[model samples]
Target: MTEYILLAIIMVFIYFVLIRNKPAPKTDWEGLPTLPEYKEIEKTTTSEGELCCQYCGHTETIERSLNSEKENPNKNKFYHACTNCKVILWRSEQS
Candidate 1:
């Protein structure tokens, strides 16, 4: 009975040390820092159908697609993101 009690105590110690003490998993969004204030210099369209940020000179393509479920199913949709800075310039779907 004393041996069983010793085993139980060992098991509880291992559980607390190895399993319960683990740190929480980090997420992708958590690592990204907030961007500072920056001015948008110019806007231009590329031949490949991408918007260019004149301030950072980063070119990013905005995705275009038709939403079949909407009333205007043929309406174009896309979100713009700077390739270099990874800043989201514009987003069509607010929600």
Candidate 2:
């Protein structure tokens, strides 16, 4: 009787451990919506001008980098992010 009870308990423990330790399947990509294509702005320099998203026409705030000016004296570098569509417009020294 003791042996049978011990065997049953061990079997139940093993079953629970195996089933609970199984990893969840990857299915997040199936339900995700596709993102729209990124749009590139024609103009580079903001120069304290208002930035707007080309696709949604949402207004954006311009962020200027002083570090870029220190590195390259001739060129300017800045980024503008749209409030509504969250699009980023940037101008690098190379552009």
Candidate 3:
């Protein structure tokens, strides 16, 4: 019984250390509403802004345009992922 308990404990520790997930996988995609097509704003209220993660609720300010003109010319949408959660946030309309 003592050996079995020790083995169990070791197994649990290994599972947590090696197999445990440090960060949860991204599930926002296909769940949250997709961001609308980006539109270049001749005049935008907030040029530099931040996007808070829906899962962790962590806010990250990005200097890049809210809407990326390079990727989606017709629709200017900034594509970025959360450093912590690695989840894709929304691309505002240069706001």
Report the C-alpha displacement of residue 5, candidate 3, in angstroms. 75
Cα lDDT of model 1 by residue, 1-95, tens digit:
99999999999999999999999875333332222212232344445645566446566544433244442244544445677776655534322
Task: Score residue 14 of candidate 2 by CA lDDT.
Answer: 93
Judge candidate 3 against the unseen true structure and give its global Cα lDDT, from 0 to 1.
0.51
**What lDDT tens digits, residue by residue, belong to model 3 across residues 1-95?**
99999999999999999889477664432233444421222221233544355556556534234343444466544455556677665444343
For candidate 1, the per-residue lDDT at 60 reads 53
How many backbone clashes can be found in candidate 2? 0
Best by lDDT: 1
lDDT (C-alpha) at residue 39 in model 3: 20
Q: Is candidate 2 or candidate 3 better by lDDT?
A: 3
What TM-score do all the candidates reach, one by one? 0.35, 0.28, 0.29
- Worst 10-residue lDDT window for candidate 3 reads 37-46
Relative to the true structure, candidate 1 reaches a TM of 0.35
lDDT of 1: 0.52
Error of 1 at 91 (Å): 16
List model 2 lDDT by residue over 1-95, tens digit each: 99999999999999889987788764332222222222333332244454456556555545444354444465454444556776554433335
